[model samples]
Target: MATRRDPITWFDALNVVLLTMVAAACVIPMIHVTALSFSSEGAILSGRVSLLPVGFQLQGYRTVLESAAMMRALGFTVYLTILGTSVNVMITALGAYPLAKPDLVGRRLIWLLILFTMFFSGGLIPIFMVVRALGLLDTVWALILPGMIATFNLILMKTYFSGIPTSLAESARMDGASEIGILMRIILPLSTPIIATLTLFYGVGHWNQFFLALIYIQDPDKYTLQLRLQQLITDGIGYGPTVVFGQADDIPVESVKAGAIMFATAPVLIAFPFLQRHFVKGALIGSLKE
Candidate 1:
C-alpha cells in the first residue's frame, strides 16, 4: 500500500521559488532574443525592447532568408545533420552491440582503448593533416567523418545494450538466430528509447557543427549554417551592409544576430519534441549501471 505524504513545507516552497528563478534565467534570454528579432530597428537601437517586441517588423528574418548563401548553408547543414546522425547511430550501435556481450574476448582492453580517446587526442594539427591526406578537405565528408563516433555516446550505447536480458539473446541463439538477426530483430526493437535519445544527441551535434567546417571546408558553398552565421555576424555588423533606410544607423546588430540564431536553432527545437519522450528514460537507464 502507498503511504500518505505530508503537505508541502517551507523548504518545498523555497525550492519551488529557486527552480522557477532558474527556469526564468534560461527562458528569459530566449524570449528577449525572439522579441529583439521582431522589433523594429529604432526600437532595438534605442534599447527599448525587452521580453516583448516594440514596433514589430520582419526585416531581420527577411534579410537572412533572402540571402543565397544563407539558403545554401541551411541546406548543407540539414544534409550534414541527417547524414552525420545516421552514420553516428549506425556505427555506434554496431560497435556497442559487440562490446556489450559479456562473452566477447578482450572487451575490457577494447573498452579501455576507446575510453582513453575521451581523455586525450593527437591535437588539431595531426587531425587536420589526416583529413587533408584523405582528400576530404573542402568536402562534406570532412565535416561528417572526423569525429563521427563520439566516445561518450558509444559508452552510453554499450551500457544500454548491456541492460537487455542475456536470456533473450541466448534464446535467439538457440533458435539459430544469427548475431545480426538478434541485434536487428530483438535488441533494436527493445532499444527504442536509447536509440531515439542518441539520435537526438547526434542530430543536434551535427546541426551545430561549426569549428569543423571552419577548419576543413574552405569553399563558401560548403559552409555550415553556424559558420556562415559567424561570417555574417563578423562581416555585416549583424545587419547586412545592403540594409537600406534613412534609419539605417538605428538598426540593431543584436536583432540581426538573434534572427540568424533563431534560423539556425528552429530545426533542432522542432526535432527535439519527437525524441523528448524517450530522453529521460534513456539517460537514466544508460547512466545508472555504467
Candidate 2:
C-alpha cells in the first residue's frame, strides 16, 4: 500500500520562489539584450538602457538586415538547416533501426565499433586530410557528412526503437515483409516522438552552425547566418559620430551584438516547444515493450 504524504508545505513555497528567481536570472539578460538592441547609440554609450528598450529606433535592425552578405548567409543557413535535417533523419533512422534489434547479424560487433568510435575519434587534422582527399573542401557536403550521425542521438534513437514490441516485428516478418518495409510501414509511423526529437536536434544544430561553415565554406556567399552575425559583431564596432538625421551615425556595438544574438536564437526558441513535446514519450519508450 502507498504511504500517505503530507500536503504542500512551507518548503514548497520556498521552492517556487527559488525557481522563479532562477527563471528571472536567465530571462533578465535576454530582456536586457533586446532592450539594448533597440536603444540609441547615445543611451547605450551612457549605459542607460535596461529591461525596457530606450531611444526606440529601428536603426540597428536596419543595419543588420541591409547587408547583401548577411542576406546571402541567411539564405544558405536556411538551406543548410533543411538539407542537414533531412540527411540526419535518414542516417539516424537507418543506423538506429538495425542497432535496435538484438537478432541482427554481427549486432554486438557493430555496436562495439560504434561505441568505440564514441569513446575515441580521429582528430581534426585526420578528418581534414580525409575531406581534402575526398575533395569535399569548401563544399556544403563537407559540413553535412562530417558530423551527421551524432553518436548520442543515434543511441537515443536505438534505445527508443528497441522499445517497440517484438511481436509486431514478428508479425510483420510472418507476413513476408522485408526489414525495410517493416521499418517504413510499422516502426516510423509509431516513432513520432523520437522522429520529432531528432528533427529538432538536427535542425537547431544546422541553423546555428558557425564553426563548420568557417572551416568548410570559403565563399562569402555560402556563409551561414551565425557566421555573418559574428562578422557584424566583430567588424561593425565603432564609437558614435554626430551625423545628421539623413546620414547614418555609428550605432552602439552592444545593440548590434544583441540583435545578432536575437537573430541567432529566435528560430530555436520558436522550434523548441514542438520538439520538447516528443521527449517524455520517446525517452521512456523501452519501459512498456510487449
| C-alpha lDDT score of every prediction, in listed order | 0.83, 0.79
Taking the tens digit of each residue's C-alpha lDDT, what string does model 2 give over 109-172?
9989988998898988899898889998888888899988988788888888887898998999
Residues 24-62, candidate 1: write the lDDT tens digits.
Answer: 998898889899899987888888999999998888888
Locate the minimum summed-lDDT window of 10 residues in model 2.
238-247
Candidate maximizing lDDT: 1
Give the C-alpha miss distance for residue 206 in model 2, angstroms.
0.8
> TM-score for each prediction?
0.90, 0.88
**Worst 10-residue lDDT window, candidate 1:** 238-247
**Model 1: lDDT of residue 139:** 91
Instruction: List the pairs of residues colliding in candidate 2.
Output: none
Displacement of the residue 204 alpha carbon in candidate 2, Å: 0.9
